[model samples]
Target: MSEVPPRAATAAALLIDALRRAGVRYLFANFGSDHPAIIEALAADRERGLQAPAVVLCPHEYVALSAAHGYAAVTGEPQAVLVHTDVGTANLGGAVHNAARARVPVFVFAGLTPFTLEGELPGGRNTHINHLQDTADQHALVRQYVKWSYDIRTGRNVPQLVGRALQLATSAPAGPVYLTGAREVLAEEVPVPEVAADRWGPVARVPAPEAVVDELIADLQAARAPLVVTSYLGRTQSSVDKLVAVAERLGVPVVEYNAEVLSFPHDHALHLGDDPHPFVAAADVVLALDTDVPWIAASAQPPAGAKVYVVNEDPLQESIPLWYLPADHHVRADSGLVLDQILDRLPAGEDPRAARRAAEAAAAGRRIRAEHERAAAADMAAGRLTPATVARVIAGLVDEETIVLNEAISVAPEVWKHLPRTLPGTLYGNRGTSLGWSGGGALGIKLAAPDSTVVAIVGDGTFYFSVPSATYWIAQRYGLPVLTVVLDNGGWNATKRNLRRQYDGGAADRTDRYWVNLQQSADFPGIAAAAGQARGTTVTRFEDLEDALRAGLDDVAAGVPAVVSVRLDPISHQAEDPV
Candidate 1:
């Protein structure tokens, strides 16, 4: 091991040391002119055989941020991200939104222009682009999305500032945090402060109050019809077990709305359907656990006299500007901790109607499962390859060791319906409605859990947004073999549906509308083949779907990334009214 450097070391070295002490393993970065000092520092540290975070070079800013998002989501720990000053930061807007919405802790760092115009130190005002890129308020670009933003003006304060940023980012309602450093400041010498390895201790999860737990228990025992709704309940594997145990013990049904992660076992008896509208409408008491939008109020509302209780780290959803969910009691605490407390405070005996309620919920779950199977069979019988059929086929091929990352917006309902996720950390999706998150996120997930098979299911429109060439190249270079399945529906199906919903029987509702159509689909398989390190295949017939998926999975198992594209029929399910 390399000895500790002198106190008068570059600020970048101190920053790197602080990050390493904070348990950061990887640094996802996109290099640029402004990053020379930090780059040199990292190179020097490696040359001396000092322990430092391994750097992963990303082809684009979005890929870098999204990769960090994926790693954090899987490990429940923040990773570092470095980008160029202005243009690079702008490219991360969409990715930052996804991280914030998912509540993933990410430490974002960017290089700023030199503070001194004249040559005062190394890496100070070397190029004309530096002057052109410098801005008075670079932090403003990402302030709205991050939990905290700061400018490291002095080299001596780098360690303290970085420590604080990590603390805030991993605290309650964890999210991304941003920090900017000027070239001159980073190159300057600074005194190394005596900081502990775990300077910022693990984030303290706030538990629900005794009174709140008692009240919730009383309501659960009294209510004849109760429901539990959650979106991100399975942040950790232990949390998933706790949530399931609490719901089963109380005989309450759980409905996962726009689920981004597998919170409860899909095959469990107390597990209600994914659609929360019907359950919310009929529930006498609703327990919302980390759900942002439980139900669409315009389409379905809870009973007028229903007692709605919400338990989340951030009950208000501070990232969203205008959030108005009806709740009778708002307990600001960690969802997993609250569930544990509720379970601990349970009364001696079960509810009088617990057995009956459990049986009814189980029956409802069976009906929902049957309906999904029938719909898939009907679609197959009609000789049309539907998303549900594809999902079921894929689900049948993989086991608990496979991880599925989904960015299939229009086909999500089918994906959720057919693919039953029982293992924790087996499913992930875009929580922020971003198009390209899954592809890059899969790479990060694979890096975090290299032993598991990582598969990404994306739509044609979302596939292009994923920058497939860059993602696949990174996979091949890093020896990360991920299986990517493209659901090619010819055009932007979601956009067309939205347009028709708003402009039905109007001029814009015509099929020939220019903005609604994504003409000339590319051969995704061909693009993947061009990467030289990956194999690609295309399936046009439903009979070939299973075989193609199996072949792709085989390639992944052999340490080779593969892409399988399925040309789907351009049928709009949204055109029909809801049943």
Candidate 2:
């Protein structure tokens, strides 16, 4: 970019340059026809020594996006997605929702069939392009999930289009953006723009209103005690440093706000995992930061009549949900900027919030201790092996480096405590409520980090959602080994709990009802075998369940895929709720 005159490049190559200039480092995608031009362009870049974002081929559109989601969580930078033109966009939309829910920034590009242009060319190797693929507009498929989307109409428009999308997607409350490349557009000759890095270039304004911040800050200052809850401050390691600085400077107790990845390391003195109800009640002021602020017990909501301040990049637009409840006073601004401003302005002479932070930290320690005690007591008293017992038994068997992917949300406490995640990289779970995702995700994690063991724990309610086909994909594509724990609860345990909580316990008998229960349960182990998992076992008690899991882990360590099904109480599994 040394002020050279414009040079001719294919539209696809120009788009790649724009992305490369935009600081995108990874692209997760599956092969597709309409995208051969882009792939060819990527190939040319490799030939010429223009570095391409490492492309990770995914088996399914969902897996590609999920991997990107995890990558964004790890890197804290925008990750890109390239999919086929028609069916690809349609398949990738669900993955976009996962990114949006996690607030992960993803730039998605889908290739379009250029049938009209093909008609202009002599009979081509890829003939009857219209008959083979779709030329009709497909960007409309994901407009709702993405923040911005448009088809590049001309080759000359590549730089502006890519730059604008990247800038917007990486700004405050980052999420997904969709872009399209017509086959003809990919073929057109255009000059690539001068390379310029754009991330953090535009000032990140708290797009949320300002008055709400003032009101909330005043309310917080007036409170005798306050708690701040968020899933995390930063998505990457660099973000963690800034987050730690803010938390330490403020002397505020930071609670993990319904997070998958550690927002704050669990062992930190001021860090408490989600149980904000008591803390909120005890506090005179409450600050809910980037959190999904809601009680699992829908019956009991966030405490009423407390001085509440809700701050976010986009403050609860129109009574939006943080976790469970709507925000009170909303301030739209960057968390890092706000933390800096508040720290710069506040008193440093005395630590008034120390006692409160200490109290919550103490409570967290007690909660952890109690959970351990409960696990021990259950192990001692369990007559027949159950999910809880099996989990405890397995904990005694696995190594320290083993990684557990938990999809058992209903029995999360069971799985979370079964094998403690004392060290980093020991456990992973979905932050938001997306089931069936873990079945495929665990395989991806294992493949990415193959030196370690990967175990996926999923509830029966979620198992069928991620069919055995997903597992087979893991075996066929990555040759990855994973121990999948199918928690065979009778029904959608979480849904039944909802029904019980609703209608004043009117549907008690629905537990046995056709629609509410797993009356037609599938042969889970058989399904696993069909999906290419050898030595899949169905466990009915702790006698064989833990043993089976240990054997599976060892087999996996020796390069074999395995599955173990454990019977779990659909109701009253671990604790109906963690709180």
Candidate 3:
């Protein structure tokens, strides 16, 4: 047999090289038969010592995408997620919806069923399963959820397609993008394109119009009651700094409602509590900065005469088919850039009423803090293993060097109130309405900040949804040890709360069976232990909580994943219970 000259670079090889060139550091992958070409190309690259994005094998697609989401949230650098055909895409589930809603940039690609059947192509279908896996449109699985979707038709343009896909993925209002290609296309040999790296770069952040900035500042300066609301602006550290500066300069109270990140210091004098209803009702000038839903209209709304301004990268939320937020001004620009513009354009002196407003805000903040502190103390004294109690204990464990992933659902509001995240990047939450994000997100956070202590505060329901075995296995295999503290109330507390909220004396509430309850038979600590080298502990008593948490933290410090499950008091059935 003659030794044939090796064919030119395969599409998969080119794709890997393209990812490296685009500054991708990791490729979270869940493989299948559809990905043989990519698998072989990666192996060949390894043999040749060619530099490419490091591949991290994920047992599930949700974990792969959520890890990518976590990495991007911390580093502001999008990572790649590769999966199998339609089946893998389907398995991605809520992670896809979450990534899109959270505006996290994750490059997700999948292999497709082979186009050829009878050996006409180098990577034709050799198995019977390929026929069953064929889909008319694989991109349809995630098309609506993703920012953009495309299919790579040939190896000749794989690099360009990848470049375009990444450009969109990392651009303003960044979100996940989907790409797919058949096995034969991935295996086809083709020449690399001569393209400049600059061509593939993300679109530069745009500043708000000077006139709009001038008008907004004037409104703040003239208004007696001005309020600033943000959700995820703190995704960037500079944004948080600028927001703080702007709020201080204007003596405007800032409310971080349902915040996905720590937008402003909770201890700041002008920082109001998470509930924006009262503030919204009183705000004469409301600046909704980078927040999607500043105030729920169903619950409360600003005065009809008040000037409401919405500033965001995608102020219009074009992707959302039905979004209606009445705003006097809708400025479509980067929040950080607009904030810089506001800072630069503000008048030299503070307003006459600034001191008065500051005093009022500080008083309001003190009252709110006192209430939270009192609630926590009462829970401690009552020997009730409540969310507030768990949160207070967890708060003691966090520091500037720690990154907390909040996915505790019903318990998250308590976590937010008790855990005062003064630093910008120290705290993060899954804003995508996904149940199983924190485990994978913690892994990604660990990957991004290897020295920082990563902790995931998850609900018991979310723990089951997170594919704990896969996440722990990946953590153990990759040497990424993170502490996971599960706030176990033994059921879907959020679902029960919703049921009660809509129907005060609902049948489910009356029966004390919401149908959202999970089986209490499973031992979470044992599950964690069986998954990997994760040390697991169950804390049923309030006094033992601190020790258990500290032990978990110690395990994490010693380079081992830890799971500390704290069983808490279940949701109250009484109508007087806070919804």
291, model 1: CA deviation in Å? 0.9
- What shift in Å separates residue 472 of candidate 3 from its native position after superposition? 0.4
Tens-place lDDT digits, model 3, residues 1-579: 111114468888888878877889999999899888888888887777764689999999899898999999998888999998999999999999999998888899899998899999988999999998998888888989998998899888887888898899889889999999899999888866665656888899898889989989999888888899999999988788898899888889999988899999888988897989998998899999988889999988988799999999989888789898999999998888998898888878857677777888889989999999999999989888887888788888768658888899887889889877888888899888879998788899899999999888899999999999889989999999999988887788888888899987878667786766564546887887888779978898989999999999999999999999888765543333255
| Deviation in Å, model 3, residue 519 alpha carbon | 4.3
Sort the predicted structures by lDDT, highest score first.
Answer: 3, 1, 2
- Write candidate 2's Cα lDDT for 423-448 as tens digits: 45556667646667676566556645
**lDDT top scorer:** 3
Clashes of each: 0, 9, 0
How many Å off is the CA of 524 in candidate 1? 1.2
lDDT of each: 0.84, 0.65, 0.87
**Candidate 1 RMSD to the real structure:** 3.4
Model 2 TM = 0.80
lDDT tens readout by residue for model 1, 265-334:
8888787768998888888999988888888888788889998998888887777888988798888998
lDDT of 1 at 15: 85
Error of 1 at 334 (Å): 0.9
> What TM-score does model 1 achieve against the real structure?
0.96
List ranges where model 1 is wrong by over 4 Å. Answer: 1-3, 510-514, 571-579
